[model samples]
Target: MNLVALAARCRAEHDYNPLCDAIPYVRFLGISVSEEAGEFISQLAFRPRNIGNPALPALHGGVVGAFLETTAILELVWAQETLMIPKIINITIDYLRPAGPVTTYARGTITKRGRRIANVTVEAWQGDRSRPVAIAHCHFLLELTP
Candidate 1:
């Protein structure tokens, strides 16, 4: 299945985004996307393998980082009409709070998009949207091919 095509269908149908299934890691993490009031929201459900500190029983920081990063990439893809695959330039992540063993959600906003680069901001929250567990700023190199 072509994820770009799936995403387009979802966008037109105003249904769930199935593009996450095209990425193995994202599927392993149980990431899913939904549209809410014209906004796209990403979610990651709690899983045992995602636990980092077994003592704290909190999610691994790397897992959270990947979640945010992947969210940004998908957001960029959804923004454009073409099937462009973005390469990561850099990602800066800030862990604000411990992510407990609970379903976490992420939302990404494209700050800027140029001819070759795109800047995205993503936030991950567990219990409350206002209280984000972590935030990430990512720069991606766009594949501007015909």
Candidate 2:
């Protein structure tokens, strides 16, 4: 199925499994989404394969980055009812602390939105939401269906 149809199905069903399953990397990363208080929260289930530093036992920087980006994308889709996938213009990630070997949660907020573009900020936390492991600012080009 096309992304537009897949996203519609996800919204109608209030489940993101099919949407995540459509993306191989997202499925491999064990990313899932849930609604909390009318907001979307994304989770990344910890896995041994995601460890970048075996000694420090930290999640790979790339994995964390991907998780943040995915969260942003999902939020955009949910918030705007996007008809197509948002194309990334750019992303800047700040690693605040090492992501411990634990499930990570992320929330993306739309900082700004225009007819053709959107700015999103995402924060990922391992245990304490107050102490974020990483934060990301992302810009995406939205392609709305007419």
Candidate 3:
């Protein structure tokens, strides 16, 4: 779905900005959706600043995990009729390369969906899409109501 249509749909169906509410800490980054592209229908962009880095100067692992989860769950939030807030069941991340101090983009896809569970895969990239800096596979627990 288009970005504006998606936003309206979120407000109509999910009651508020699912993107912002779900990923509040990353809201200042102004991360929004790009067009539907191939396997992934939406995208999120984040450039790790000095503050987001670890003591040793590497991108914080928690940020990577949050980015991946937000991107994946959002895709589902937009696609499904009844909004479901996904819980983290499990996540496996592979850091192919250290996230550099550049604009990093993330794309995610739902690999499998069950009654109350879903599997999602995500990749974060900078400059190169084919060679992602980090990749993640997550098992999600989705519940429709609070």
Candidate that scores best on lDDT: 2
Q: Which scores higher on TM-score, 1 or 3?
A: 1
Candidate 3 differs from the real structure by a C-alpha RMSD in angstroms, to one decimal, of: 5.2
After TM-score superposition, what is the CA distance of residue 13 in candidate 2 from its true location, in Å? Answer: 1.5
State TM-scores per candidate: 0.90, 0.97, 0.71
Clashes per prediction? 0, 0, 0
What tens-digit string does per-residue lDDT give for candidate 3 at 1-146?
Answer: 44445545665664435555445564754455544343433334445452256554566676666677777766666556225556778988888887765566787777888888888888888788898888899888877664
How much is 134 displaced in model 1, in angstroms? 0.2
Residue-level lDDT of model 2, residues 52-137, one tens digit each, is 99999999999999999999999998886467889999999999999989999999999999899999999999889999999999
lDDT of each: 0.85, 0.93, 0.65
Question: What ranking emerges by lDDT with the best candidate at the front?
Answer: 2, 1, 3
Worst 10 residues of 3 by lDDT: 35-44
Q: What TM-score quantifies how close candidate 2 is to the native fold?
A: 0.97
List candidate 3 segments past 4 Å from native: 1-8, 11-18, 28-30, 37-58
Q: Best candidate, TM-score-wise?
A: 2
Clashing pairs in 3: none
Q: After superposing candidate 2 on the true structure, give the runs of residues whose Cα lies further than 4 Å from its correct spot.
A: none
| Model 1: ten consecutive residues of lowest lDDT | 76-85
